[model samples]
Target chain A: MNVIYTDNNATTQVAPEVLEEMLPYFSNQYGNPSSIHSFGGNVGKKIEEARSKIASLLGASSNEIVLTSCGTESDSTAILAALNSNPEKKHIVTTRVEHPAVKNLYEHLSRKGYRATFVPVDKDGNIDMEYLLKNLTGDTAMVSIMWANNETGVIFPIPEIAEEVKERGIVFHTDAVQAVGKIPINLAEVNVDMLSLSGHKLHAPKGVGVLYVRKGTKFSPFMIGGHQENGRRGGTENTASIIALGKAAELAAAHLDEENTRVKTLRDKLETELLKRVPNCIINGDRGNRLPNTTSIAFEYVEGESILMMMDQYGICASSGSACTSGSLEPSHVLRAMGVPFTAAHGSIRFSLSIYNTEEEIDFIIEKLPPIIERLRNMSPFWQEMKKKSA
Target chain B: MWDYTDKVKDHFLNPRNVGEIEDADGVGDVGSLACGDALKLFLKLDEHKRIKDAKFQTFGCASAIASSSALTEMIKGLTLEEAKKISNENIAEYLGGLPKEKMHCSVMGRDALEKAISHIKGEEEKKIEGEIVCECFGVTDREIERAVRENHLTSIKDVTDYVKAGGGCQNCHEKIQAIIDGILGVERPAKKEAPKLTNIQKIRLIEETLEREITPTLKKDGGDIALIDVDGDRVLVKLRGTCASCSKSELTLKHYVESKLRELVAPELEVEEVQ
Candidate 1:
């Protein structure tokens, strides 16, 4: 069966071009970049070339980017570095809707005797900037927020927040794993001290990520080992995935316009047509400030897993912020934080499109999904009670 | 993705008897909107009061929908007495079985059937019989106990899977464990009240605890510890055997020896590694 993949925010398929660029590194060109031999020295050049390409994607210099295992490691390195370097500061601040990479770490840090404050969000998944700013004080060692939420795709105004945070003399970082390629980010203009991006989110293979550290930012290493990544991260380079990430970054730059236009249109059309066709449905995030490729929709009185299961029969892939899907008794914390009701939170489906998605795939989903929702609603006793109440 | 059986997939994709039976003898409604799943069962009886038709409207996941469809299919042509006897396991067995996490879907089927039968008997749905344990899911102690006793559930996670108890907030996990241990006849080690000990008494208890609790385990790794002297709360020790020259001997002394001594003998006792 032909598959219509729309769950790009979860992870994208490795672009063919990236795979082609990485093929040589996996086999014939397997020389260690740290080795002194010419074969090894030549591969080092390719690693630097890949770094420059990734650096160009974020408007950072080659020296500023330190390759790491993944986005989670980058986040840990950045936060731990800030806290360790500034031992006098005892508090750490972050938004409530951070991905587990940052949120769980902060919770763990709080248990380890550091004060932690998670700023709340409004019903539209919009961060409470006032509350975030008010919580920042002289004691805060670092402030780490996200550029775009992974589940809801609501983009935060990082540049403005970075400037505000820096003025307070606190180290500012953003987990731009979801935002790096989907949205335009020029770190040259943004005052963020640190930024993180995962390769797999932008059509690169997994196991490779980059942490862009601004020059003159006080730093410490998370991984203490071999003097790789300029002793910033010590793991032997993930040669193949790093090369793949470089190729993926180049492709992302070339396709940035198409991603913003065609992909955004497809995402918008899917949301508009789905809402129009299905009743008792509402979108989850702020429409104006969200990532162009994402739309989280909530269908009331029906569960998300059932909707996703029905969609899967037609080979249409998607994701949900539902508790049943995640094996948690409660729905997604992001949705709950936004005050999405239990009725809708259990049925929130996220359709995150990429440049690979087409108009026809959106049309197919638009045609097939409404009936599935209606079918589930028909079997829903609440739906019957709702109609009776109205009648 | 859930590895749903072909039977589950079939039933979920095409549910049976999926509309309200308008002229029904009984209607049973269970679960709530906030709980993420609910079911309404409609039963129609024959002239002889046997179940001639059964229909349902459910709001949940694949296993839930499949279980509802399977329940409607299972209860047909059975008397109220026979239909009421159908268990959650029977419904799960009917569909080749559900994932352990999705077992609540089968429980939902059984609860709806029980409610439908009670509705026809003109019984005011009995008030909840026990104190609520899991506040997140509104699960009760009696329900949790029954699930543990029936399913031979051992862990809090097992209880949660069977009855959705201790699945939320986790404030009631200890309560659930108490209930499980009660049913399973397991004696829990009582919380030891640390009695105040004199200087000599504390030192003796520390040595006793080391011999009885710590020595046997340490001997497994060719390691041993000898108490030097006790100065107030500090118990200095000499690491012997393989632990004597080990690089992590200090770590073992502080992390393992001190913690065990503190926990078992006296909370104030500290272990220091000495030559």
Candidate 2:
């Protein structure tokens, strides 16, 4: 069976070009960047070159970028550094719909003598900017928010938020792990104090991420060890992944136009046709201001895991915010936070596309998905009840 | 990403007895849309009181649908008395075995079967008998106790896996633990008698109690406490951060902190704020 990979939000397939670029780093060019020898000195230069590529993609300075193991590390380093830098300040602000990388950390902070204000989101997955502004205080150490939500693909107004946070002298951070490659970001134009991007979310191999800290931002290190990442983060670099991420960034920059045009068209077509064909289904986010390559659709009355299982039979990969899929009793926090009805929340399916996806794949999904939904609905007791009530 | 058995996959892909049994002798519905799963079981009995036909309509994950399908197949030829004896374990065993977390799917099947049997016998549906424990999932103490005893569940997580009792908010973990302890017949540790102390020993103990018992809970609410002095039976302390600004600091000190100290230390001790 031919694999139709549409679960890019979870992780993307590593681009072949990125793998080719990283092959030499793992074998022939395996010198530690920290060593003083010429062989190692050459590796240090390559690392700087890689850093510059990633920096260019984000419109940031090479010096501002700190490479870490993954997006979670970048988030931890940013948030913890803000708290540690201003130990006297015991308050933090975030949204209720953040990725666990930031949400769990904020929750942990709340348990450890910090006041955490979780700004709410409306049913369309739009944040309450007034609530966010009102929550900011002199005692707030940091405000961490995601640029684009992982499950809903709803884009937040980060630049405007950053400006407000900076005016109040509060450190602002954005988890752009899902936003960086798919959406255009010019950090030089935005006043964000810190931003996190994961390599694997694009077409790079896993286990590498970048944390961009503005030049004047107060800094404290999370991983205390030998001098690495300019002492902002520690341990020897994941050399191969770093190299691959650099190549992926360059490709992402080149493919940005294709992502917005072709990929967006495919995503829209898939979403539009599925909704047209399937009865009683609803989209779960602000359709206008969302990531170009993602769609979250909730097929009412049928469970999402069952839909995913049926899709899996045809080698079509996708994901769900359903309770059963997450091993939790409630649905996705993003859906619940947006006040999506329980009838729809438990059946939300997220299909995130990548540049590699073709129109044929989208068409194939459109053909296959409606019947699956119909079949599951036929088996659902809720569906029968709904039909009977309507009748 | 669940490691579902081949039997489970087969049952889910080609579910058995999928439909409503019109003019059925008994019908039972369990779970709800809010709980992320629901099942409706229908049974048609012959003149001899044997199940002539059984069918189900389910809204759930693969294992749940499969469990419901398996239940209908299992009860098709059995008498009502024989069907009443079917346990969740038997339903799970029929499908080779379900994932530990997916055991609740099997439990849903058993609950529907029991309800259907009760419906046929003209019995009142079992009322929620005990106080609600886990408010997030609306799981009652009776439900938790029954799941614990039947599944031989040992941990709060196991109970969650079997019945989704402590799966959300988790405010009722301590209560769930108490229930599990009651069922397991584990003796509660005997309370240690308060040790007699000199002035220095008393001060040290008071400080230790504040640090170990009182401070962490206060910290969770963005507050902190400091031991100022221990004079006679009175323990003086200072509140900081949100506690200092809070209108309920006195209540916290007199009720929460003081009560905890009295329980852990000498019962005659009185707590006061230095400020």
DockQ of candidate 1 against the true complex = 0.65
For candidate 2, the clash count comes to 0
Q: Write the per-residue lDDT of candidate 1 for residues B1-275, one digit (tens) a residue.
A: 89889999999998999998999999989898888888999999999999999999999999999999999999999999999889899999999989999998899889889988999989998999999999998999998888887677899999888888777788898888999898889999999876788887887888898899888888999999888899998898898999897899878888898888877887777777766
lDDT of 2 at A12: 98
Per-residue lDDT of A146-235 in model 2, one digit per residue for the tens?
999999899999999999999999999999999988889998899999999999999998899999999989898889898998998889
Instruction: Report iRMS (Å) of candidate 2.
Output: 0.6
TM-score of 2: 0.89
lDDT of 1 by residue, A97-172 (tens): 9999999999999988899999999998888989999999999999999999988899998988999999999999
Find the candidate with the highest lDDT and give its number.
2
Off by over 4 Å in 2: B190-275
True contacts kept of 2: 0.92
Question: After best superposition, candidate 2 residue A237: deviation in angstroms?
Answer: 0.8
Docking class of 2: medium
